[model samples]
Target: MKKLLVITVFLVAASAFLFGATYRIGLSLSTLNNPFFVTLRDGALQAAAGLGVEVIVADGRDNPAKQLGDIEDFVQQKLDLIVINPTDSDAIVTAVEEANKAGIPVITVDRGASGGMVIAHIASDNVAGGMMAGEYVAMLLGGKGNVVELEGIVGTSAARDRGEGFGAAISKYPDIKIVAKQVANFNRAEGLVVMENILQANPNIDAVFAHNDEMALGAIEAIKAAGLLDKIKVVGFDAIDDAVAAVNAGEMAATVAQQPFLMGQLAVVKAFEYLTIGTIYIPVDLQLVTSK
Candidate 1:
């Protein structure tokens, strides 16, 4: 009886190995505190289920060091693939290199690493999205307005590119002056505080452009507190549900919508493809969301 039991256990283990029970994927997200990122995580989880794989997720919590540590853990675990939503584009290079050294393919979602070999990068054209927002603001203001910019986290490509695009669009209208620009770190609370200070500094500002809806929403709060809501037009990115509702309510001017859910799903699909066939880079689309 003992011999028969041993034989059966051996057969079960062999079968499991032969059939390749599951593929392990490591997802390192920049932060899970925001609703947009939460949606992204859900999309990835759903895709992993459909592909019959398991995904282990780690949140960087918007810290570069934490993101690096998470990548190191993924590498040490010898995961089949690693997907990163970088907190800082340049800061993530070292982490990406380590993953490359481990021979584990890396895919960036929503944000790209400034250096190292990334097998695939999946995100929207942020520059174009920013340009769309800028143009909308210009038209609404009739090409002449004093605006304040609530920037995202520093050292991030998303912030840099979007700022560049906004600048390029507004340059055409010399009358559109950017009175003050400040970084809110893409946090709602920070946005509120920073915007409150900006309001005190520039009392007559006509418009505000925030890199993301979180910051924009915070700015709106500040505007309401100061009784400047009717005078100030706010534009934002991400088109998150709340932001969309704000637009419909005429509380916000417009927003450029980047599909975080789609980005997450595609990142997982590309990761699976890389494991099976090879590497591939995919660019997703961004849309302009407006009240009208």
Candidate 2:
């Protein structure tokens, strides 16, 4: 009887040991300063809570080296899975490879990496979003206008693809010339400064299309300061809260709405799914948002 009782206890202990460990996820975001990314983080947190998993978040602050370091740290910690919103898609490959070497699966959200093995990538189609923005802007100008393009971070897939799609659509209208194209690095302050400089070079710009809402807001500041808001229309991507408000107030024209919250939630879901069934690759949706 004593032997039987001991065996039963050992079996229960073994079972508990095998099944009691809670999964941990590492989420690295590009930048929390951007309101869109903040929304993405909140959505991810909500999903993690629902799944009974622990998530440790790291902010890259739009620095590629820092983002890479964050991924390496997660690898060292031996986290169950790592989700990265890469600051620079090309620069993040080595870090993702390191995680792969550690036998940890990786998931990229929002912006994807240029290389490396990812269990799944969950994000909106940025190219399509960009095309939509271009078409809308062209229509606003009646297919002929002097336009300024405020670009995002250089070398990142989001920047490249968005620019590509926008250019493709704008190419249809030869009369609509891109008078000035500058990289604002997806920062509000830089956007303002860049727009101010561009305004000096091309005083009669008809419209502006910024890669993100932050830049759009910055351009609006410059336009307002110069008293050219009535003349120049602005279209921005990422329908952040402020951008939405701006649109309603007639300060901006339109914006492409990427479902960041849904993308975040789905990223977590896919991470969990990969752990369970080895599933990979989840796609999110995007939409064009205009003033109501």
Clashing pairs for model 1 are none
lDDT of 1 by residue, 149-232 (tens): 999999998999899899899999999999999999999999999999998977899999999999999999999999999999
Per-candidate TM-scores read 0.89, 0.89
lDDT of each: 0.87, 0.87
Deviation in angstroms for 185 in model 1? 0.6
C-alpha RMSD values across all candidates: 10.2, 10.2
The parts of candidate 2 lying over 4 Å away from their true place are: 1-21, 280-292
- Candidate 2, position 145, lDDT: 94
Per-residue error (Å), model 2, residue 140:
0.5
| Worst window of 10 by summed lDDT in candidate 2 | 1-10
Please give, for residues 1-292, the per-residue lDDT of candidate 2 as tens digits.
2354234334433443466645789999999999999999998888777666788999999999998889899999999999999999999999999999999999998889989998778777889988999999999999999999999999888888889889999999999999999999999999999999999887899999999999999999999999999999999999999999999999999999988887777777677666654564333445889997
